[model samples]
Structures are given as structure tokens and as C-alpha cells.
Target: MVQFEAVLFDCDGVLVDSEPITNGVLRQMLGEAGWALSQAECERIFIGKAVRDERARIEQETGQPLTEAWMLAFYVRRDERLRAELKNVAGALEAVIAAHGHTAGRIACASGADKAKVVMQIQMAGMAPYFEDRIFSGHDLQRSKPAPDVYLVAAAHVGVPPARCLVIEDTATGAQAGLAAGATVWGYCPQGHGHAFQGLGVARVFEHMDALTAALNHKTSHGNLI
Candidate 1:
């Protein structure tokens, strides 16, 4: 079994079901900007990514500049919808609790998202207490996911080396970040299909939060190592 000193969580799809809500707002805004796209196409292009990260594509498709003002407006609309529609991912609370115990409180939320949005969603899902001040956001770093900066910060903040941490992520981008940080990453594929994570080097691809909890509670009680 893998012995991990800490557990790092990704906030969006892993803990809170906010991806669809956020992506919906993004799709609508893109459509209004003259770039019509189906919800699946929008998600496929943007999920697990920061909006500004895809500025070129968005601007090219919309025939408009991906301006700061437009991003601000998107954030506003997205947050409004999130506030009204967000909910905890199924079994997320239980998984978090299990991780907390298994790691002896060495748990942190690290995401490639804005800190405000990540915080609000966690609080809204009633998971604020578990993370408290241990939240790290990529917006605060020079680089986001697929770069490893945020996860590196999170592992350090939790007083654990990256190699000794277990990162729970739901996207290949996130898995790349965790692996780049030198942590063991577990992909959370709620749909039970992990094709997206292929070749990402994630240690495991689990379809449910309960599976993660079970792994953390397995005989070694130190999280899945193999």
C-alpha cells in the first residue's frame, strides 16, 4: 500500500458538481459572442481548464477579443448559476472524511481555479470546515494545472513532500499536475469511463468517491500505493 502523508483534493468535479453549471454559463456566453457550441463540445474544450487559458480558441471562434471585461462578466454569471445549482459530488463528503482520518488531518484543497469560486463552492457544499485555511488556488500561482505549481504549493503547505501526497483529481489536466508535482494521483471518473486519463500516469482511476474512501481505508490504511 502507498503511504501518504497528505491528501490533496481538486474542488470542481471531484468534490462539487460545479463543472456543468460553470460550463453552461461559459457555453451561453460563447454563444452570445457568436461562437455557438453544444454543451458537450464546450465541456470537452474547457473543462478542467481556466477560461483565459483558452483565449486564442475562444477569441478565434467568437470573432471577438477574449477581453478582461468579458472574463469578469463570465465569472459573475457563472458564480450566480453555481450559487443556485451547485451540490456536493455524490459520496464526496464521505470520501473527504475518510481522507481526513487516513491522513491525520493532512488534507488540502488544491485547484486550478479562482480561489473565490473554489471557496464559495466548498462552503456551499458544507465542506468548508474540513479544508478551512488549507485551500490553494492556481490563480495565486505563476502557473496552473498541467504545470504543477498549485499542487506543489498545496503539498508544501500541508507540510508534506509532493512524493508523499495523494492527489485526487477528475481530469487528465489535473492528473498531469499531480504527477508533475511528484504525488500519487487518483483520477475520479464518475462516469466509470477513464479513457481521458489514459497515458496520464495516474495511479488509479476510480468511478466513485466511495472507491477512494475504501482505498484509503484498506489494510495499510495509508491510501492506495499500488
Candidate 2:
């Protein structure tokens, strides 16, 4: 049995179902900017990534400079769609509660997205109370996911050693960040789409949030702790 002192969650696909909404808005905006990508193409490239992180690719595809003004516009449009359509991932609330109880509330959300967007999504999903003041955004760090900056910061802020943190992530980029930060990362692969996490160093791949809650409970029932 393994012990974890904290639980770190990646917000987008793990906690809330906001990716489709955000990606739809992104695809629409990119189309208006001269890159007419299908929804699948857009999601394939941008899911679990911050828009600015792919500035070069976006510029190359759109044949236009990636600018702050464009990003701001995207944020505005994305947030508008999110506010209207965001929903908590199935069993996410239960999973969060289980993790919180398992770790005595030493839980934090560490995401590669913008802080405002992350905060808004959590609030919209009614998870603000659990994650309030404990949300860490890579946008505020020197480096984002796949670099370990945000997860490291979150582990530090939660007063847990990175090695003793359990990170729940839905993307390879995020799982890599958690692994690089010295945490045991679990891949949350809802709908059986576990391909992205393949070859990634996640300790487990689960198809639903309920699986996470059950795992946490199993660990507790088995008295698995250092």
C-alpha cells in the first residue's frame, strides 16, 4: 500500500466537463482567424494545454501573429461559454470529498490553464469551497505543465512533500508534470479514452471519478499509510 499526504487535481477534464465548451469556442475563434479546424482537430491539438503555450503553432496555422489581444478575446469568449455550459465531471464532487477526507483536506487544484478560468470553473461546479485559495495555475508560474512548476508549487503550498502527493490528471502533459514533481500521478481517463496517458508514467489509469473515490476508500480501509 502507498501513502499520500495530499491530493492534487487537474481541473479541466478531471473536475469539470469544460473542455468541449472551451474547445468549441477556440475552434470557432481560430476559424474566424483563418484556421478552419474541425472540432476533433482542435481538441486533438489543444486539450489540456493553454492557448498561449501553442502560440507558434496557432500563428503558423492561422497565418497571423498570436497576440495578447487575440488571447484576451479568446478568454472572454471561452469564459462566456463556460459560464453558460460548464458542468462538474460525473462523480467529481464525490471523488473530491473522498480525497479531502482521505487526506484531511490537504487537496489542491493544480492546472496548466489560466487562473481566472480555473477559478471560474471550480466555482461554477460548486467546488470552490474545497479548493478555495488552494488552486495553483501554471500561468502564474515560470513554466507550465510538463515542467512540474505548478504541481511543485501546489505541493509546497499544501505543506506536503511532492513524493507524498497523489496527483489526478487527465492528460499526458499534466501527468508528466506530476511525475516530474515527484508525485504519484493517476490518469483519469473517463469514457475509456486512455490512449493519451499511454507511455506516460502514471501509477494508475481510471475510467471514472467513482473509481478514484473507491481507490481512496480502499487505501483507507486497508490502512495504507506511512
Reference-based lDDT, each prediction: 0.89, 0.88
Of candidate 2, the 10-residue stretch with the lowest lDDT total is: 217-226
lDDT of 1 by residue, 105-221 (tens): 999999988999999998998888889899989988899988999999998888999999999999999999999999999898888778888988887887767778777777432
Model 2 residue 158 CA deviation (Å) reads 0.6
Give residue 186's lDDT in candidate 1 (0 to 100): 88
Q: Listing every candidate in turn, what is its Cα RMSD in Å to the true structure after a full C-alpha superposition?
A: 2.5, 3.2
Superposition error at 29 for model 1 (Å): 0.4
Q: What are the clash counts of all predictions, listed in order? A: 1, 0
Error of 1 at 157 (Å): 0.4
lDDT of 2 by residue, 1-226 (tens): 4457899999999999999999999999999999999888998899878888889998998899998898899899889889888899998998898888889999999999999989988888888888879999999989998899999999999999999999999888889999999999989887677777778777888787777887777643221111
